[model samples]
Target: MVHRKHNRVDGKGRIVIPVKIRQAMGIEPGSMIEFDYMARRHQLVIRAVTETDQRAHNRET
Candidate 1:
């Protein structure tokens, strides 16, 4: 399920992800996240790197 929430970056460049969005994405404290900045599109992508993803990534390395 995809969820969207509007957030503003603080002075220190930190943005708080809404609680509902976090829960929907299975994100919790200490979870690892990957951030990608699409310069061409001027967009930022945030993704959670779960254990399964890490395992797959390790195998590819």
Candidate 2:
């Protein structure tokens, strides 16, 4: 499924995720999301993060 939404970033660089997208992704108030920025495409990508993802990221660093 595709969820499309647009929201303004606050002065602190925080953007509000849409309720529909949140619900679909099972995101709670404190859920962690991963963000990837593609400078060439000028787009930002976001995805829900899991414990396994955290472990792999830690290993990489």
Among these predictions, the greatest lDDT belongs to 1
Residue pairs clashing, model 1: none
TM-score of each: 0.80, 0.79
Q: What is the lDDT of residue 27 in candidate 2?
A: 82
lDDT of 1 by residue, 1-61 (tens): 7677788999999999899988888899999899999999999898989999999989999
Superposition TM-score, candidate 2 onto the true structure: 0.79
Stretches of model 1 off by over 4 angstroms after superposition: 56-61
Top candidate when judged by TM-score against the true structure: 1
What does the lDDT come to for candidate 2? 0.90
Give the distance in Å from residue 13's predicted Cα in candidate 1 to where it truly belongs. Answer: 0.5
- Model 2 agreement with the true structure over 1-61: per-residue lDDT tens digits: 9888778999999989899999999888888898899999999888899878889999999
What TM-score should be assigned to candidate 1? 0.80
